[model samples]
Target: MSRWRTALVTGASSGIGREIARQAAARGVDVVAVARREDELRTLAREVRDTWGRTVEVLPADLLTAGGLAAVEARLADPDRPVDLLVNNAGFGSLGWFHELPIDREDRQIRLNVLAVTRLASAALAAMVPRGRGGVLNVSSVSGFQPMPTNAVYGASKAFVTSLSQALHEEVRGAGVHVTALCPGFTRTEFQAVAGSDVRSLPPWVWMTSAAVARAGLDAVTRNRAVCVPGAGYRAVATVVDLAPRDVVRRLTALATRASLPAPEAGR
Candidate 1:
């Protein structure tokens, strides 16, 4: 059984967010599913209700907008309908040289990944700290562990998430609230297509299923772990990155990332 009675999961229309919602419901927790895609959210709601007999609330809202953010924040803060868990999983990324990517998109990425997560977490903690019970699971990425040359903004955003989660974990541990950062590496999700990341060159073993990542994250948060790196290979990479000198890690990451990209098309 889940420690939470109700969970509010962002980015719930697909991928890791969708899996988290399904798994949480299966574990006996009601869910509030948030995403920009209403149709997909409704579909997931039907599936969850049918399979697990759990109440699934489909909340279609773009986190990038103020109104959407307010709606979700209000739900988390509702005294009568309290949320026992907050899954900050709604985010996206872009893969390209920092200068080449559209500035507007990068700004939106930071807003969703960093600003939205921060706002939601703050709202959840405000409620949970008073009640002395609850959990916040922030979905981050292994890219945050090192300098991602082609994926700089996304990496920085996740680093903020991981840092914030760890700090909050210590802050609320005594108050009975658990805060955890779920840092996943290369996972099989719509993320690749959306980010324009061509991972065809990577070995099969490097990718993880969304189900496995979701399961690991849920279990870790329930156990009050400050950080959870889902796969053993990723854990090894994170460990090495942590111990390695900053310059060495940055140089190696740049080289590896550049090698993965196709050569630039004929110059303008």
Candidate 2:
């Protein structure tokens, strides 16, 4: 197994982020796990240390905050010792009518999903470019390929991620910095729980394991693939969505969004 040496992963407390950290550690990569939940981050750090016997450092920061993002930026800019890999996976979705959603929640989603991703990717590149060897894997979604009615903001953020990943890959090709965007479809993760959606209600085929998705994503990064949509089923769906008429796709997505919305509380 090739060691990553030093790797930093945002949103490392759980789900795909957690799986990425564990897999990297298992292969002898020293991991810095970043997330808002200190307790969960610490717990996962311990698990990595015990399970993989690799060094695991936890950095608890809400990437949406200026102070937190600044702190992360400082860590990534350290030239004396640079990280060899970066995994941008800190993001979430709001499953509801767009107008009914709270303004602050919408802002948080964009801040963590888009702004933080762009900033961190830049910082990682600043360090990696000088050293001339590293990888950046941005975790996007199949939603990025189409209009998502209920997950509108989230989907837009991921589309930004995918676009940025492709652009960066071309720009940094000769500089030894490989960039990849991982477009996954409904992986088994705490993402739905955080988004307040019932994952179990979705069809079994729609759910992929976080480990499996992470493996595919990391492989793409190592191989320097510009974009990766892991499963055959997901790739097929993405192809159809890519080719479908825009207006028709939007209407169907809006109907599905309506079905996913929660009923108003009894007192309200």
Candidate 3:
């Protein structure tokens, strides 16, 4: 049985977020599914309700907007409803040279990945700390383990998430509130398509399914683990990244990223 009575999961329209909602419901937790797409959220709500007989509330909101963020924050702070879990899973990435990429998109990425995650976490913790029984699972990425040359902004944002989660975990553990960072490696999801990350060259062994990632994250938070790196391969990679010297890791990451990209045209 799940420790949580109710969970609010963002980015619930698809991928890991969607799987987390389904799996949490299966584990007997009621869910509030949030996403920009109402149709998708409603569809997930129906599926979860039909499959597990759990209450699934569909909340449609874009976290980037002030009105959307306010709506979700208000829901998190609602004492009557009282969300027992907060899953900060709504994020996206852009793969390219930082200088060449659109500045507005990068700013938006920070707002969604960093600003929104921080705001929602604050709202949830404000309520949960007083109650002394709740959890927060922030969905981060393995790329945060090191400096990603091509995907700089995304990496930095996830690094912030991991750091913030660990700090929050230490702060609220005594209060019986769990805070965990779910750092997943490459997973088969719409994330790659949305981010324009071509992972066709990456081996199948490096990838994990969304369901497995979701299961590991939910289990980690339930057990009050501070950090959960889903796959063995990713865990190993994260360890190496952690141990390596900063400069060496940065140089190697740049080289690896360059090697993965197509060569520039012979003539500019």
TM-score of each: 0.97, 0.93, 0.97
lDDT of 2 by residue, 111-212 (tens): 888999999999999889888999999999998987788788888889999999999999999998899999999888888888988666677887889999
Model 1, CA-based lDDT: 0.95
Candidate 2 clash pair list? none
Off by over 4 Å in 2: 262-268
Give the C-alpha miss distance for residue 23 in model 2, angstroms.
Answer: 0.5
Ranking the candidates on lDDT from highest down gives 1, 3, 2
Q: lDDT per model, in order?
A: 0.95, 0.88, 0.94
TM-score, prediction 2: 0.93
Q: Give lDDT tens digits, candidate 3, residues 1-268.
A: 7899999999999999999999999999999999999999999988988999999998899999999999999999999999999999999999987777899999999999999999999999999999989999999999888889889999999999999999999999689899999999989999999999888889889889999999999999999999999999889888998899999999999999878766543442
Candidate 3, lDDT over the whole model: 0.94
Off by over 4 Å in 3: 263-268
Error of 2 at 57 (Å): 1.4
Candidate 1, which ten residues in sequence have the lowest lDDT sum?
A: 259-268
